[model samples]
Target: MACQVQLILAIFAALLAALPFLSLNSFPIRRLLYPTCRCFPGEPCWPSDESWDAFNKTLGGKLIKTVPIGAVCHTNQSFVPYDAAACAELQAHWNEADTHVSSPSSITAPFFADQSCDPFAPPSSPCSIGTYVQYTVRAAGASDYRATIEFAKSNNIRLTIRNSAHDYFGKVTGAGAIAIWTHHLKDINVFDYASKHYTGKAAKVGAGVSMSEISQALKQQGLLAVIGNAPTVGVAGGYTQGAGHGMIASRHGLAADQVLEWEVVTAGGELLTASPSKNQDLYWALSGGGGGTYGIVLSMTVKAHPDEPTATAFLQFNSEGISTDLFYETIATYLHNTLAITDAGVGSIFQLSSAYFAVVPILGLGKTKEKIDELVQPTIDALTSKNIPFSYESTQYNSFHDAYAATTVETPVAFGQLGGRLPPRSDIEFSTTSFTGALRTIAEKGGLISGLSFNVSRMPDVPNSVLPGWRRSTISLVTGLIWNNTDWNANLEAQRIISEEFIPEIDRVSQQAPSSYMNEAAAREPNWKSVFFGDNYPELLRIKKKYDPSGLFWARTAVGSDTWVEGSDKRLCRT
Candidate 1:
């Protein structure tokens, strides 16, 4: 009988864990160290059924109960989330790039990184709620966002923001909380008149607008927006928030530098217009401080450039006859001469491994194939001297869209990943010996290396909270190790390596933590304040308090997240 009672209690606990929202009797915990934490650890706080119904009615029935995307392929409960045929289809395409992106509840980052949800594996096993937001308010406008914010604040309910869910870190989801899904807020408005910041063509993009949507739309108007190469990434989501970098960075500057104005719903339940001339503090923080840390963005306007023709250089070579010495020499030569290459108006993605090295660069607007050839000719000559087996191509595209489409990389979901960063040019240019030594040492660590170099002619006038390393960084080094999504143990070891072993070795050599671009680095990065935001962190935190004093917004490793920690139950419990 005692054993039976224990079993019943365990089952009761499981039900509570899975409950989306609670009854009205859940009063605030006075003993709680973190006042902003709406739910108690292991004792979730949920809204009453009546309150929930009211909230749903307020949104005109946009709210939906939590049904994780992974539930389709597998389930933690006795029943699956879908029919057998649908489950089979999900399993078949589980590892594809777009499968996860298009799914409402799927997040690009490993869902069970915290190891909270049982059978936490992707598609194959049930992606139990874990730390994911329990209820998603599919926001259709600023009012929806504002309404959601007010509810979360007044009820002391933890809130998470989800747009594209392409975030590498698990910022978009939180365990046992309300979520604002801005993905449905798709609105695009164009302007030809002058504004406080810029006096040229501009695009007023909704928070849910994606890279491809804006790209294709602007292409028809003979205009272009500086954006990442991915087709599914949300334009105003984490992309621009982390100071987005891409093929056109050399020509147009980082995405954060293009912002002219932003429409946001703050923690105080008021709608705001943030720009250079208004709410300057919020503007700076929102520009690149990292999303989910400030407030929910409703819309943003960015300067648009004339859609022009582009030139590109592509090189792919197998390390068939390449020696270790020759490989390092090639890497060293590129590092030593990045200025000249980027000065010629080119941005590149270099993927290297012991077995292979590939470089695809999109030249700037108005540049020609000869110019592309002239810039990359040196690397080609060096490889030629080394007798390296190689193939090269230089092409001219009539539109930037054409050039961008040719070399865009689509990263698949379901694989666990992390990055090792390289500091700015001052660190890379420490000395020839130091530069190449660090490069060769980290590169030879065995994996893939994705390198990015940024060269800019002009920057926006507003101050931003982007990583200080970006100001001086010429090249960023990133390498990732992947494991089968179903192999939980392998995923564990991979995450351990990315945090404990991989990034540390590179950070030791590259001045500090892998500070490449914040959005793409490891979420559990050490001393992230100095690495991701640098000196700007202090001010960003100040602004965080100034606006959202309750610490209402929190992401895995965003600025000012040090004061809290996530528990095994997936709750952001106070320390």
Candidate 2:
């Protein structure tokens, strides 16, 4: 026994000696290596008094101050003052629970209102008004949903289901509201694999699943599906509402187009499912009417593709000595070439900046770069003949997820540390104009253009699926200036110039295209309804009225909030 103990001690000492090297090798591991807090382990975590005070001020009296009945509570005054008693209780409960629980990571810190604003604000924005809250929910299946609904109803509070907090219109979370962060609702279940309903296979994904997680899961199952980059964006929210586009759009269709069914909670507190055979109207509305305007989605059942061959190409172009005339010529030629290649199951996306340009093209349905080259070589030759300096690289993947991640660029937060500045504070404003005909003329005249194109091959084959107003045009383009300084007047002047002077110049040359992608929209569009929702406007408004009669879901740019609505809009009654 003495000899065995000595040997064990020697091995332990050796492992300890290697600890520093392991830490150095795995920096990400360090981020997850925080010491456990003192709060009761199994109970819900609570904010310190200082944290709560800061959060209360930021909310400006929007939250309920008292704890609800049967809910655990704690009061620590700062990050340093963790409630040991609360942590202990929670830890004990967690150990006894049969289900799996994610160990708290550093990324799960207090979410402050000020933190939200900071990312949305321009440079040097104030942080004094920022506040945060920390909350936790126990792990359960259907029972968890019952508890959540009951909690909200009993507390007289509204719940905002947030997965990634990546809502472009800011509907995922709100100031001073109790945020039910759903990132913990990570469950992925593969349903029937031979059902005609899904055209083969489908998966029911929990609301909190991220795009990256879904992609990895599908890959493991020898299947693929449409998803965006920015690994952290929620699958149910972003993909569901924005009509998700991907590299394979020319062949497969938008993300919403492929959804087989959805499980959602209406504003009236009813949990429902939307699909072709059930609640079809709700299914249509939820597809592209923009999320939060109808109901909160709990899970989504999406169509999946069997293992299939895919091809991708990345081409880079430098504008060093290229004249504005030549640049415009290149863009026109590229668009024309893209339209020509669609028949061959080909689609391309052009990413342009003031200094450089990159084009990503995808060929679906078991095609190859060699075949892609057969169709695209002419366009490539044309650009090269004009002395345009460019390079191209192409490869093939076994699935759609791999092809998408290879082509999609990471999205920078509009106002976060990643993107330089935030949206302006004063009356938030935006402008847009459409283009047509004279693509070359505008380019030669030095019109700045930033364009993105996706072939909508897999979109629902139904006629009315792509809203009427937006269907007239095939390509969508946006060009604008982001103002960072606090000179409100100057920023306004710049905005006017872009809207009236710059965009009109392009419109004059190209004629008026008259359509835009609702997801990448400008707030100042005169006929936003006709532009974004197209023929679906009336239907969306009806559903909005039915589900949210009180108009409690409206935020900065949420659907159905008539910028013109008088004081009739107010929070929903928790009764």
Most TM-score-accurate candidate: 1
lDDT of each: 0.73, 0.52
Which predicted model would earn the best lDDT?
Answer: 1
| Residue runs of model 1 more than 4 Å from their true location after superposition | 1-36, 40-45, 75-85, 111-127, 427-439, 442-444, 457-459, 511-514
lDDT of 1 by residue, 481-507 (tens): 775655667766766777776667665
Residue 6 in candidate 1, Cα distance off native in Å: 19
lDDT (0-100) at residue 76 of candidate 2? 18
Candidate 1 versus truth, CA RMSD in Å, comes to 5.3
- TM-score quality measure for candidate 2: 0.68
lDDT of 2 by residue, 1-575 (tens): 98986786566456646776543113233222211211211122223456446544444433334221101222312222234465455434431211111221111111213232222233233332122222323223344444554444333333445556554334443332344455656899876654435466788898888888888888889876777545666778745665665555556767788788888777666788888777877787888677666766778888877757777777777668998656655655665666556546555666555566667554554677677776677668878899898888788876666676676654533321100001111101111112223333333433344454555533364322344422333344655454432344554554565555554554453323344555554434556566566667887788777776755454434567573221212222222
